[model samples]
Target: MNLYPFQKISFLLVITSTICLLYIPRSLGAEDDEQYLNCSASFQCANIPNIGYPFWGSSRPNYCGFPEFKLNCTGEAPVISFQDKDYRVLDINQSASTLRIARTDYWNNVCPVSPGNTTIEVNHVEYASDVQELLLFYDCPPLNIPLPIQLTSQFNCSINSTANYINYFVTQNLTNSGLTNISSTFGTCNTTVTALVSQSASENLAMNSTKDNLVAVLDSGFGLKWDASNNLCKQCNGTGGQCGYNTSTAEFTCYCKDGPNPSNCAGKKKEIAIGLAVGGAILFGIFIGFYIYSFIQRKKKKLAALAQSKEIPTPLTSKSVATPSTNLSQSQSIPSYPSFTSKSDYDKGSTYFGVQVFSYTELEEATENFNPAKELGDGGFGTVYYGKLQDGRVVAVKRLYENNFKRVEQFMNEVEILTRLEHRNLVKLYGCTSRRSRELLLVYEYIPNGTVADHLHGKRVESGFLSWPVRLSIAIETADALAFLHRNDVIHRDVKTNNILIDNDFCVKVADFGLSRLFPNDVTHVSTAPQGTPGYVDPEYYQCYQLTDKSDVYSFGVVLIELISSLQAVDTNRHRHDINLANMAINKIQNHLVNELVDPLLEFETNHVVRGMATAVAELAFRCLQQERDMRPTMDEVLDGLRAIQNEDLGSEDGQAVVLDIRADDVGLLRNMPPPLSPDSAGTDKLVSSSTPPSSF
Candidate 1:
């Protein structure tokens, strides 16, 4: 294997040149690196500070953001213009890809410089499901027919002249018996304007159709969801890259620390080749070989150091990767629980799935020594208490009822699952107590309003606040969360209205993951004893002891029926043969009695739109309630069906257009079930028997 010195030197020079060329190209791109840093930097406006990617302006360059997401920060609030029309950005929820914006021209005034229909680009952004349209007819003639008292409101306005004209504003798609031949009357107005408001605002306008209320609703603004770079940004950021847009290409670009790439930072990028002239000198080639060997050794040491000191948090797995749980033997005694209130205790304590490890004493002080008045709610696993941490953050603390092995397992299971799952509709877990703590405790972001159950039939039902639109939103949000869980190989064994918490804006926050199971990817279903809220438990799971994603769907079906009917899932006061709400809904839908099942407040009969949507929802619920798990649609399908129904209802051009073509015969064809059980002594025992899963929190 002897080689001449010249030949050996030639091979070394070639190898060194290749290595240097590889490093030089990545390091030479100073302009690309600067753009990456610029895009990575977050900005501050008057109020909405720390605004980051997908939105750039002022201090940030064009390459830092998408063209449509540019912001003008010189105003009182962040302003984003679409099609030359300016909108005041009230709020931005980056996680949800949603923003609250109000029309600048019509913020506080009924009249604007130029009245036109509100336009939005469907490709860039779209209105939220809960948003509705309102039509404002201005400068109308003295009407021969009076405006509907319920659907329209008339007010006097003086525009350009001393003469006064009657102005009317009507809620679109909410036509009732009170309004007839309204289009011709609206055509008589000189100026017509269309505006969008939230569904709750539209409902309030329907209740008291006044000029002042309409003005207030218009001032509040509506929610819009941006879709231009949501998926692209996720792909870029997932690979340790800064998300940006190439203005020249008009396409998304991923900016790595090294340089710019098309998809992600780690993706193989285009390389540039450099040619080197051969050098016959032996000393130069020998020096290059030594440099290459030293560089390799240094890189190995650097990687080894990083592996030991750095802990990368992953959303797909448990925190055992960071601080593994100790396996205790039956013969071993319980370790001494420490008072984790001091800084030293915290420094020594282990993290729970990359989340904070709270102290028993600190949580006790936060909840006022576990006062009964501070209690928010209770579940099968534990009771939740409303608390304010020392740092002044309002939180809901769940205290496990027992310190048994099963309770500990559930506590660890929840912390592992919740810390890995992130969604706007799912409840946020702030932290939890260690396994050695006196009692298991979980802290979550506090939701002030109440559960969906409270609004439907519990304490808040008398207020009649949960509108049909809000209920539909709740169902869609819950289904979305469940679908996300399924995608992540998890199942929400407990799905019920009581677990669906609502905030002031009627946004859903699904809680209670104690009964959830992290399903194995290799298996179709997990075999375990059925455990969940009685009325919401899947009948097939109870019978076969096989838990699948469809179990969540079955539970959600009961939730949907409850939303439309406003009936409790399990009502002993109801007919014994129809004790279960699912059973009652099936009997009603099968017998073509959906009108009887729907709540009167939803205007199921008066409002054709409501009738169409409710009937369609009832049919979907029937499909979800199929006894065979194989027949029921997946949670993803359920979410899509609900969204389609909502979009159709909101997309109605005319107020009278039916959202769906569902008929009585169509309902009959969807499912064929046995007749309702007779209300006899035998049936009563069967309805409320031991075989029925016991009802729990």
Candidate 2:
């Protein structure tokens, strides 16, 4: 203990160094535990590589990833199980957070006749949006001829060729109409399985005619996305620790050198506590210094104020002056209204529509100042332009003409109608922009495929001849949309082929609600001046000046005729007796000459079953086109009739019994009723002479 001052200081430093050195190994051991938890070594499979976190197998331990995402490498390829059903792992992209998986049973077998019928259900994974569904029809009866559907491949199941059935696959989503047609036409067949397939594979199935190609497409599975959120596992990985779930405790445990903990590491707690204590002490010291400085500055300010108060000022006398005249020149211009700069300002006029009010500048930039190259088409209301927003969303912008006073009313009407309606078959309303300089604009979902008219008339370059099944499905979907609108007390006054839009997948989306009117539940009809395409307009409404849901039925009836004949509603080049399609359709159907009226493009001459279905559809159209409103069926009834026709049996070679009555109640009425005069020849005079006008709106 007896030593110099320098010797004593050296002794204290040595003791401190020894204590620090003793704590270093514990820290290093903790780091080693964190590394053990990672298990980041790449797990090489047949072709897949670097399969780590969120997936564990092979050399990776169970504690390295989520329990549900465990992979098994027992087979030639790595496999994963979802809902107890095994799926072969085709590809794993960690950067994209996606997994390509296919059912093991379907992958191994060419014709999954005895499939497990199990659907993969991943808790934290979602099927990709591009996944296409395949409907497998089994045990279908032998056909005399090939049907209109795109038949992929067929197999004979039995030794007797007459007893054997065929299997067909089409690259289209199974709709209610499709199901009904399958049930009706192939009464003996059953849809055994519905499976998800990749978009590329779906396209291959659609384009290629070879049966072997389809087998390969089915083997390559669909894609799925992992739902990984910013959670404890990510945090643990960021802090150089391994993330694992403790199934017994139902909690996330971070693996460290010492042991598993609820957080990243155990030693970090002591380090954080020490840092906080030091920070708090430093903050307290600064607060004291600031208080003392403020006190001194306040004293100095008081001293200066007292010194300034000692000075004084002298008084001055007033002088008389002449006031200027109140009157001024009237040449000054009035101030103009300010332009809108934000959404709040734009929203003042868009409250009724209840949609996003995009700024004019934003849309201008999106459409490159409405370049002519971007113009999609022109209509009665406005010109539509295809625009790509800054956020990478494609939109259809309808720019209305500013001079037409009626255009404003139509614009507001469309906005109001679309805002209140939401359905899969209806086009989505994005937003609109209203400004003094620019034309009134309405934005909508951009449908790449053109209208039904383009496809039917062979005007679209990308589209081919629409098959009979597709045409029937379009009719059903359109009818469904109309029924939905009618149920909501909304009448689509203008129902035409041009308004029925299709998507890339050929799904129907009814658009153009400019003339749509909302009918009240308390009222029987909406009385207004007739406003619709010439041939499609209801004759009763035209003469009596009364609009009703039946008017829409009449218009839709004209569209149905168009679908059947593939002819313009009002073709002047047509024969004088067949000028108006609705009139011609009614006459041909009443006289049981549906074959003459069917579209030659449909190739119905050989297929008797399809020809019969076409005839039934024509009859339905005739009912919808009745002269009297009361005689015509409701949209719901029309939909039911279409569905019934689609579900009708296509008589077998064995001569099975057929049930083909569309509606039981309408049979007698439809048979005995006399034919109404042609809409063109009868004119307004005939309609007024026969019936009384309905009540006004």
Candidate 3:
């Protein structure tokens, strides 16, 4: 084969051009991957019992998701894209309310190499980094490439900076304008369009109180809806929007209202009208101009006076503007919360717990610039810093990596979502502040005992898991909280050992509500994607996108199982079946091997009182894990059953210890117990857990 040098060189040139032209956009595309959520079946959203559009889990059902992005819960943790290349399950974020993931590296084939203009159909969630919560993107450079940030429709971030070592980061202070659509040249987006409906502040969803960070989009939509009452926005309902106030302590927005359009511009139309009316009148032109000018000046003065008189009362030397029923400022008089019914009273600091405001500078000093040392922990939303205010109270301050206006709405919900809330086992939200960029901070009575996971794993003051009485108390309290939520038509989705914090005496307090939803009768179970921790999650939730109070029962059941075994959710080294704590416990107990599955630390009292509580809890856990969601008991029924067990008092002469003076038929799901976990999305897997034990609670 003899070929001329020029001929060979020409062919090589063609190959080089082809490679560059093909790889450039795909490479740049990686830099802008702001894919905030790519859930598989394994990713746990304790709040969400099912998966839906823009989210793919049961990948086995079809090639769902971008191939290989299939997810499933492993009784330990949820696994994503299990057998595919770069198949890694990242994190379930409660804060910011987005699903974060680590993606596998692959080549994008722009088929029709010899021609052009190919078509790709998308059936799953397609997130264009240029149009979503920007902080969620990862390091997939050619590092630090200048990229455009896009959020929904009509909102775009034009950040054209050189990427350093990190991937494209979400610019803080980004606000949401109800997005509609975005367009790119040649369907590729050399430019994108973002639609901002009104001038509302950034809406930050409380990702998930205590679960992740209270900052995720709970429900976002733009269907056939509109609320033209207060005249706030058009084309959107005030349904999902939350109202929040700042340091001024006053503004109350129940939701958006109907207001006039650009024609409603302050002074524009009236001024023109007066000018016309006078000019046409009997030579009243000069008088009308002078009179109108004076009127305008007076109106401006009144507006200023109103602004000055409108102020939220303040504390002696702090930044808080106390809630004063009589002295609300004009600005405070404006309602910023969504139009949901008054769920509770957020105005009274005495009822619920809330946070105090600190100048950004003061917060900086308290946290030593949010130093890693003052850091208590890092969560899905951002980081938590422990600090002591000058008043001598030790507090935990959460600084969000991104801005969240939606979280403010939750504060409104805390104050007004439902009505009537009274429960000792639940954590109280005193107040909150979405000012100075931290965006969301909740002040609660800090509990010193750590989480239930700590005690159960044997990692706290007791130096071992709880005694039988303590375990009984914890179970009862947690159940009581669950019952309360159910009563209010709300579901505490992420109920687990970690979300259950203990105090010095081991009293349990249920925390976190980012995933809590108003389970109104009209709305069956919510159909968002599945969310929760790994090992302890429910299977029915993953199989169907319907979240009910029953789902919470399933997750709480996992926590009960964890309390019994004193084991972590997952241990990579054990047999797949044994790796699941719930499965392991059921198998051992069913085969009369209760001794093998029970935590030896609680050698306290296998007596009736202790055994009775354990037995009741185990039975309840078993029902919650029913293969059918309907088969699960409601939290109220669970509580009543526990109360009955408590009333029995396990056969004590004093009478608080008899094993239910009642019969089996009296119990519903608890009646004829089903076989333990059987192991599948829809089938119960017999229980078990791996070898390594996590810390004690």
Best by TM-score: 3
For residues 163-273, could you state the per-residue lDDT of candidate 1 as single tens digits? 567777778654443233554455456666768889888888878877788788887889998775667689888877888876554567888776788778656233322
TM-score to native of every candidate shown: 0.45, 0.45, 0.47
Candidate with the larger lDDT of 1 and 2 = 1
RMSD, candidate 3, Å: 26.8
Candidate 2 lDDT over residue span 450-543, tens digit each: 6787766634513355666677778988999999999999888878887788775667888776436778999988765455666888977754
Q: How many pairs collide in each candidate, listed in order?
A: 0, 0, 130
Clashing pairs in 2: none
Question: What TM-score does candidate 1 reach?
Answer: 0.45
Q: Which 10 consecutive residues of model 1 have the lowest summed lDDT?
A: 685-694
lDDT of 1 at 486: 93
Model 1 / residue 317 / CA error / Å: 62
Q: Which stretches of candidate 3 lie over 4 Å from their true place?
A: 1-365, 401-422, 434-438, 461-465, 604-609, 649-697
- How should the candidates be ordered by TM-score, best one leading? 3, 1, 2
Q: Model 1 scores what on Cα lDDT?
A: 0.73
